[model samples]
Target: MRPRLLFASAAAVVAALTAATAPSATGAPRAAAAAWDSDLAAAALSANPAAATASGSQSPELGPGAAFDGNGATRWSSNAADNAWLRVDLGETLRIDRVTLDWEAAYGKKYVLEVSGDGTNWRPFYTEDAGTGGTVTAHTYPQEVRGRYVRLRGIERGTPYGYSLFSFKIYGGTPAPASTTRANLALHHP
Candidate 1:
């Protein structure tokens, strides 16, 4: 009886260690899921004025428009399908240097980030085969990817439900710095 008790305790310790290292149903580890990529990236270009669309919305309230509305409370959710996708159209063609995915509870296990100029022809800039699904920031510098339309094509769903995103933010050119000069140009009386 004493030996059985000792063996049970050893088994429990091994099980705990295995669970800690194993990938959860969410796809990646908890640490990677909680943080963004460590890089000083560019600002998001797909905010207001940008139109968003998707393959299929889970419901009227969870439309693709909610993803780019700049509201954390709102989100875009697709129907329960692995092929569901979300797309955003920047008003003009711009160099894409970074992208951030603020995923909801239902995330994508495998997805491809593509950019296109004509909206028909797409070129993948980033491919996420293993996603943990929290806030993922991807930098595409030196790849020279430029496009007006950016999209995330879901190849595999992380949850039984479809893919969902709070924000599908695209990043590009450097943001302008604030003026340091204290003198006001409009103050001239000449």
Candidate 2:
């Protein structure tokens, strides 16, 4: 019975992976659901690589990619604009639970953490009006939002310079199908 159960579990995993990797009707590859404990912002994920972009950079060296590079020494600095913003493409739509903003000397006094399915339309999940800089961790736990693109829009600058960030880390889980979710819930409940 143990061997049979093992084989059944393996088969289920394989089928789930296959379905998750399949392309959608729109011809765009589907966003694979990731483990709830994993960091969705990590570029190391070969399946869905995350990328970062910004409205404007202070210089070529301090580009947007530096913020998501997982290197503390590097950072992304925006130009002198109160409305400067930084966005990250999570490669797949995810249920974002939390976000950590490691700010540099220059930070946003008033900013909004927004999520979007398309890059054009955005919905704010977190807003900081009295930002003291440093590191800010915003948890959307009880009420998580879903989107592929996450943006940090600055409304007011904390410093005389522009907004700067050492890192913009995102934490989320991939959404499961209704059937899979129900099955898991039933298994645990029973």
The candidate scoring highest on lDDT is 2
Error in Å for residue 61 of model 1: 0.9
The regions of model 2 sitting more than 4 angstroms off are 1-32, 44-50, 177-190
Question: Could you tell me every candidate's TM-score relative to the true structure?
Answer: 0.66, 0.75
Q: How does candidate 1 fare on TM-score?
A: 0.66
Angstrom error at residue 86, model 2 = 0.3
lDDT of 1 by residue, 1-190 (tens): 2322112344664575477667889888632111123211112223343377789998999998888776789899999999999888775667777888999999999999999988899999999999989999878867888887889999999999999998877766422223212232123332
Q: Assess candidate 2 and give its TM-score to the true structure.
A: 0.75
Off by over 4 Å in 1: 1-50, 174-190
Model 1 lDDT vs. the true structure? Answer: 0.75
